[model samples]
Target chain A: MTKSLKTVQLSHGGGGKEMDQLIKSVFFEAFNNPILCSEEDAAKLHLSGPVAFTTDSFTVAPLFFAGGNIGKLAIAGTVNDLAMMAAQPEYLSCSFIIEEGFAIDDLVTIVNSMAAELHQSGARIVCGDTKVVPKGCADGLFINTTGIGRIIYPDVSANNIVAGDAIIVSRDIGRHGATILMAREGLALESELTSDCATLWPIVEQLIAANIPIHAMRDATRGGLSAVLNEWAKASNIGIDVNESAIPVADEVKGLCELFGFEPFDLANEGTFIIALPQAIAQGAIEVMQRYGHCQQAAIIGHATSAHSGKVVLTTPWGSHRYLDLPQGELLPRIC
Target chain B: MTKSLKTVQLSHGGGGKEMDQLIKSVFFEAFNNPILCSEEDAAKLHLSGPVAFTTDSFTVAPLFFAGGNIGKLAIAGTVNDLAMMAAQPEYLSCSFIIEEGFAIDDLVTIVNSMAAELHQSGARIVCGDTKVVPKGCADGLFINTTGIGRIIYPDVSANNIVAGDAIIVSRDIGRHGATILMAREGLALESELTSDCATLWPIVEQLIAANIPIHAMRDATRGGLSAVLNEWAKASNIGIDVNESAIPVADEVKGLCELFGFEPFDLANEGTFIIALPQAIAQGAIEVMQRYGHCQQAAIIGHATSAHSGKVVLTTPWGSHRYLDLPQGELLPRIC
Candidate 1:
């Protein structure tokens, strides 16, 4: 095949010879596997017993950001959802909608990022679909990923949190939202401030393997830490008491939030996660988490309490308390 | 909740209270079910044995056509892939990328179409994600659906077609492609011509119930009949002899093809499917398929042969024959 065109055309998605060549040179080379190479309408798998199914769509602005591109985020986002359910990320279905005239080289770069991210979780993209629309019909590219995995640890539910359980933050919060804000504004920060976009299967697998009695776990994505806490409080019907000073927020994120007039707790974090477990095992869990580079700032930020059921209470360092409500308005669009 | 805004805002996908309200009022009510109501990061499914996984992204232009909208096409397209593999469509993940300022009422209508189409397959949309881009960032709306189903019948491979097997189409060809062309061109026809977009699970279920010996099955979506036949011939390494006159094409479709100087075999069909089976079972399959209202025109158009292996030969009514090649260039974009 000759490399005459630098950008994708309608013919690239027309289900013709050009489309076949695009799949072979791009998608097939990056996501090579026996099942995918079969090129069947559907991929066949021998899945048995309980499974975890999840999905996410990535349409972030400026397709490339400080820490990762949309393709990496697409893979990590869906894989993290499965890992939150104590499922080992196994297979994923990737679908892309690209605008006509999108640079083929840029697409290849994004796809390669996706392949690199999948390596961290040992997940495979078995089946996929691609569609190209007119140039003005879409901005650039949007990706949707749906994942299925075997449930390694069952009954990991948000409704399972109970009084006396400790809530732990996996890492510093709000990096993703802050990074995107800076990228959109064309800011050059003095310190390295990047989105913490990464696959969480490794850390989650460690927790499951350690036999920790995890009550609930979730990644703080769109609505950030605030939304996760509020949902957990409502679902578990328990009150959560937080120590404001303990939650880790990097100085760069705090600075960006101050400049943007936003709350760090309400901003997104791609790799940050919240875990609920028995108070006795909080230290052990933190130690295990800190072994990973991304989890260096892990700390216990809150605990489930019996008072004021179905609400999250935040205590300031100066001894004042207030409800950290679920985000009410648009914090930021396309943060994930 | 007040029905104040007629259009969707960026806040509706901001992972806040507005987004929650939108979900409850629109998607939740239409796709109400126990699994979807769990409100977890992922849906827990108890799947066992062999399973089929597939994905499709629907960027169909105009959003709505005579018989279906993008939502209906999204569900049917993925479900049909599983049904073609003899898999019982069960679970699906739906993701949407909506443009800001898109009408909320139109979104609801499209979503309702999706729910209605799911009834034909008994497949549930268990987990979903929604995102909103700024106005002009996307063209109204786009949807991606990924489906998983249990494989009731195994080894139905495209490469399994052998000599003496008959090729049967479930319904008339080219209706879907022509319908979109007419809609885009704003043409007025005397007779109604609508897309064949529909769920094929019901008809496929009946065929499975009757124990027809199916060797290969596929839907002629983007590249239509010519793509399927050419692919089948190459994959099976067998010659395919098609009686061009025996293939069914609706009057409206034939007229549109004539006007556009396009071949009917190169047109798309969303709901239509092709099956390969022993000559002895061809009539049995056709009888079961024609029982469906949309499948009244079901017929066998070709047979697998040993002569001219890896080629699809078309026999005309006037005693002429030629090779039917796979579609080339961009016949249509975003047809499904």
Candidate 2:
């Protein structure tokens, strides 16, 4: 009976003895905390005042990625959401849906990655649940993380961007998207091109500590920079004019986009983000961000305007302008 | 392109135009609320003092089940977690992982079911995310719900179960597990056997409102009544003596268990719960629970004792005593 339990079986998620053993030996040992070890139905917490709540289900393909794996993404993804809201991430709930026969070793590796990533934001996995499906019923594994944090900076909204606000890209665009594309397509790159899938809490915390009047902040995930700019334009009822030449894109990302007929602005990004603030303080924000290695390439890419409300206008290197619309069709699936 | 849009496509989860349309027309319309429509990265909440946080992932096979579908279970399961802690269910985050080519109509049905279930506990889905995987990579769909609620009563925990505490099962056991088994095995029982899938917040609210001194409360979900009792025994360092005949088991469940060599006490349940309270208030708690139609069969099936600490002793109909250990092996997979 013990021999057959080398890999996770249906019994491991059945809330029985096998499940108890797996949770204790794996999850409890990795994510040890007072609230979690209490074994209550729900984790008791002492959250007060304004809190930020968010959820994300990570289904990134090729669980082991170039820079990080799905477990790292799961923790950082949800933690970034709270950070984007200018909140200090505090608590998270991690749930897993595993397919039967998934290697126990792989599961352990993924869980350990999650525990390591949690330290990046000082967040705790306070509560969780697990479900397992039969073989072929699900891909190797999928993780869902829900996070809550205290909102230290309030009134930061997509609708809060004003006409004089400046747009800043945190780092080089499309590295994450291009990295995943390369990984999936088996492309061998000469340079050390990896995913920008790091936790943004450090940089975001720095910005708040530096006292930048941040109007809006968001990670350029999923629909990428173009989607974020367009949504901001529509939500804040302002026109956004971006300089095409100023937005930084890595050489490898540019090469992949050209080869795959994808736009750098249209692909997904896991770790990169966009920030909007009053133009007077934009340079200060850039200086604060540039102190970090990941944000060394941060630059002012655009500005909000009243000319073309509900739209984003891109000024090309040739001094001609065109609308940068929201991305329409599927570019890459399971990028996150 | 429109011709192929009858079912959910990969684009619906691509974080692009199609994904936006799907969210607006499907989820937004069904779960319409001010917080959700705000379109922020994280929903801003005003939770104060003590709060209860919990999460559950639902991957039930046969999305359309006997009494409820996966969506209903998703909301109820998470809400019940908070309710079990004597918390007032308030806000929830819903995330979905969908398989490509899953029926759009079925997805809508599940979403509607989720919206209906939210009304039972007055919990709003404040934030959500949707992801689509390629076909055959996953089953129909899986849902993860994380909830936060204000604690109305505190210190209700498994460790608080003291000697002289009466243990009561909210309703019949094994119905959900048996129903799923019958569905999977193609058993056409003569009796109308449906799962005991339901939202327990309404009944739980009544108990708390009546000021019952509850020591511990938990829903018998995965490992059923036996698991709950065993955990209570170990956590509180008290022996649990349950009268085997007093436990309510329907005729269909008993027949199925007898035929399949399964124990009714070890089967999964969705709506059923067990309460541990002082014997002085046990009758009052029962009266409050029995007010609901689903709890008509609620009975005091056990009592916490000092004898044989850290174990569960089950007295058979012939007065023979045996240790009812935590269940081992997989009795049912994806039962939730």
lDDT of 2 by residue, A7-34 (tens): 8899999998888888888889889999
Give per-residue CA lDDT, model 2, range B1-336, as digits (tens): 322467899999988788888988889989999999897899999988999999999999878778888999999999999999999999999999999999888898999999999999899999999999999999989999999989998969999999999999999999989888888888845558998988899998888889898899999999999899999999999999999999999999999999999999999999999999999988889999899999999999999999999999999999999999999988899998
In the range A34-143, model 1's lDDT, one tens digit per residue, is 99878689999888889999989899988999899999999999999999999999999999899999998899999999999999999999999989898899989999
Q: Candidate 1: misplaced stretches above 4 Å?
A: A2-4, A189-191, B188-190
Candidate 2 regions with alpha-carbon error over 4 angstroms:
A1-5, A188-191, B1-4, B188-190
> Candidate 2 has what TM-score?
0.98
Number of the predicted model whose DockQ against the real structure is largest: 2
Fraction of true A-B contacts recovered by candidate 1: 0.88
Counted clashes in each candidate structure: 0, 0
